[model samples]
Target: MNDSADYCDDFYNYVCGGFVNSTLIPDDKNSVNIFITLNDKVTKQLNTIISRPSQPDEPEIFKLAKSLYKICMDTNAIEEQGVKPLFDYVEQLGGWPVLKKDNEWDESLFNWKENIAQILENKFWVTGFFGFYQTIDIKNNTRRVIGLSDYNAGLARKNLIKGLEDKSVLNYFNYMVNMSVALGAEQEHAEEELKEALEFEIKLTNLTRPDEDYRDQTLAYNPMTLGDLAKRYPYFEWKKYFNYELSPSNISVDNDEIIIVSNPDYFDKLDELIDSTPKKTQANLLIWKEIRSLSGFLNKNIREVNGNYAKIRTGIIKGTPRWMKCTNTVSSTFSIATNALYVREYFKKESKDNVAVMIKNIHNQFIKLLNSTSWLDEETRINAIKKAEKINQFVAYPDELLNNSIINDYHKAFENFEMIGDSYLESSSNLDFFGNKIGWSELREKNVPNMWDSFATRSSTANAFYSSSENSIMLPAGILQGEFFNNELPKYMNYGAIGGVVGHEIMHAFDDQGKQYDADGNVFDWWSNSTNEQYKKKAQCIIDQYGNYTVKEINMNINGINTQGENIADNGGIKAVYLAYNDWSSNNELEKKLPGFNFNSRQMFWVAYANTWCSKSRLESQKLRLIYDNHSPSEFRVNGPLSNIEEFSTDFGCPIGSKMNPEKKCTIW
Candidate 1:
């Protein structure tokens, strides 16, 4: 798609430099777009329905997703049940003081905050300087809230507070000191106990709050209650930890349980670094974050020494293929009892009736971009068209995931679990203790909206989201297909690639933290103090124009107020699929030059939206997604919204101040 280059100087490297110079990037991927090439064709169509064949009247969710994909492709029953079930679950949680031996130490029978609240209620990987979970209460949206917060650290929070003296966070603690000497320790006591567990996660990244200062969704909502977080942080133990997870099921948190303190200055500098460190450096940083999140289900040399710091922060040499991480751990913990056999084998009802006519022509081109915007007013443009007619365009899968008595009553709500073909550390410890014991017995007897078993374990993700707390948008059938959706391309290249990703997730229901949630998805604030000060003065002119755009291939700079709500849904999703393809080519016709490209259908609709954000990455995964991605690079999500698109300089005519015709332009739909 070079076509003599210059689409007003840099149309995303002139149509993503021919698929970022014909793809490649893979040695187990660091980048390759079009949602990782249709999530590697939905992981080779769920590895042909997880290497089929076994069928004795199958269906108990495909025999538990083929016995958790043959217990993660039984590599000699995980190397003859090696790292002895991770050293017998670290000698029942009282050992790994980095391979002990120092006269069998015991800080008076250590409890390290009740084993860091049972390693964050049995999830394991939850890093230490705080993090508890159980969300959905971004401002009392009823039920579920928990939080505890502040944790990001495993490295990169500006290299644990040195704010970049770089050495890729000491080459990720020399790959966790070669995974604590491949789980045996003693290579100089595994490099001084993994450099004192990387200086206790650089003192919990200097006691928190640095994800671009918590992208202010109303100053990161606080809330508190478990007796005002034990009188606002009286050194841990929040009521024997939420009465050891809701008073053994009688479900009562004793001091009016509300717990939302979303980082009161990260518990006032983590109560001065847990009252000046050492109880053996907080028991070697919660036993090095539960033995580095259960050392990649142990064995194959502790999964390549816990996959060598994601191949030194994302060059990704290997990992994730133990039968696609046991078919993505049975498609993300039995996604509503395994996404109805991945939507009855690779979803398609003519691609959900042509993506429900492109989500009804991108919600009538976002009501003609809120009837051609004017910093919104007429009663905030009729409550933003009654919250875009109650958004909810779910798309690709979920129709109760093709209901087979709700996938056999969600696999008979885990009727007596079993994985006879044993070991992936006992099928990931019997599916993490019977999927949290039938997810707290169906969240204490029948809670609803079963996200098709969490979208059947991220069915090879080619994601699309919006949720707002269910105002909905979803999409996922792994982003439909290749260059983002297909039913045979042209309707302006599927309205410039998946109708500009269904108008960038229906313009993320009016961005900036989804305009503080509304249309029944609660957290209410339906605009109007002069349309919320002219929508924060047009979201501070797109946060001072993408915060003076920098990211020159990860040299870094673009946080733009924590990526201004996905750069306002990537400029109102390429102007709602370029005004829903000029209202469907004002009665259809325009498709002509893409075969041997000469760029015709309006420069092939911006080269199918910059070749669906073509590939290339790995400068250590673009400096670890420039400190953990929010989105802004993919060449500023296509030249920061086609340089404030005036129908992209009148269909590439440009001239009016070249460089894609910029002249103080930063709009917000």
Candidate 2:
């Protein structure tokens, strides 16, 4: 935890270890990372808007966001209402057997088929045994396509199959059974029923492919028609199910609707599993998933139950603060509206302009990296440079957030939901209806299928991303503040922090999965076979490098394959930003350092880079992230890249073969 330790040996500690030791994690927070810290700051800013009394001058969407947040904050109202609203919902789905009177479970009302139809009609996105969502077709980004993929079984597939053998898995099982008991079933009956439900989820997980399989877009993209889906997996009533989902909306479909079934084999296996599983068990499983999905919106008891259960799996000792949780829900439900208001206050045009210049600097340096990389042949290098140059940037926020006409259109999309009752559950249901239909009308005009759209995450998010489909890097306003960037700060600091972020996202376009897509965002590999092969060999070095770094508290090694894309991006991004800083510094020729620090500007650049990633995580949070997150821990993020960079070794004057100056280094741009 020494702050003055030689950075060349362990830079993450030299920069962050003391900070981690000094900071106290709030009772409500499981862990605090760079992203979490910044998000909390933004949430506080949003609280000002949410907690304020309604004003006559406020924008229409701003009013909507405030109303939603209030309902989320009204815990007394949520608790007073009790389980009646939830019971009413379950009754509409034909009632849960767990809630039925002893030996009097009615077979007539609990029709699984009718229940599913009603669930679909209500626009409740319940991912039971199957999941359905709309996205731009991977093969054709211009058009939207419906994807009925595998249901997640409420946990990661690996943990789900491992079952009770894993401590976390056992905790989740106890939670499922506890939920059943809370709803008024006999304790023994609840346990027995939920055990069968767990078995059903296990079988579902076994049939599904792991996350690694989806990394390759070529393998992931499986385009087929409705007719083909039926032909391939005859067990599912494809026509009836999809028609039920689409009938309530503007989307129309029949046997000819072009659907993208990502995993045909999983569906085939699922068909067999579904046919063999009992109707009662299927009903129990589906209802349990729905209950799980909606429980948090119910009374305090239900919310606490779900939160406690999630804590076991996530290592989160407590639930997020009620205000923060509500803000997240409201923001996601009405992102465009929330973000439109978000843009006016904390985010402005000036910050966007600064980010634009930084983006250009990073992009130019990235082009050089692409052109100069030795691993890629001439043909591959030229295509890589084209992809890099074509990478468009959406800085701070999208332009539409500032346009009244578009914001009004989006606001009008949910106008009907304005009259939803004061209760949280009531508003949630209305949002389900309003949220589904929000952009559906436009699909008919554009002939676009359901696609990914989120202005809130895009507008105020504390992280940056590169969308392979859009071939663009999005830098949200939330990440624009903090140690990441400041216009008044020295150029060295900005380049090390936000400059690296822009570069990281840009480099994602050439990462393992991203390289599968071309400059046009189409799923086409432009690399020669040899270049592709060589790229893997170099990437393996990173996989090995990161895989060996253990999360000491949990003693879990990094999942390298799952995180390879991010690892590559980290290395490539730092390289890009460093070189970009050198280019900028040489041209501008500015000389300044922090008033008290002894480090030169060149040394400060790397120090700033490490500081941006400083964080403190609890054991539970660390354990969960090791299994779930794509990026390695913040510690390894600093050490891994620097360990492989010769410039770092030279700057720190580390001898050859030192901990930070390995003789062999891995590099890929």
* Highest-TM-score candidate: 2
Per-residue accuracy of model 1 over 182-261 as CA lDDT, tens digit each: 77677787677667667767777776667776655656668778887788777877787665554434454567767676
* lDDT for each candidate structure: 0.71, 0.78
Q: Write the per-residue lDDT of candidate 2 for residues 522-630, one digit (tens) a residue.
A: 7887999999999999999999888888988888999988999999999988988888888888898666878877778877888888888888877878888887889
Among these predictions, the greatest lDDT belongs to 2
- Clashing residue pairs, candidate 1? 331-457, 332-457, 335-452, 335-453, 336-452, 336-453
| Residue 615, candidate 2: C-alpha displacement in angstroms | 1.4
Structural RMSD, model 1? 24.3
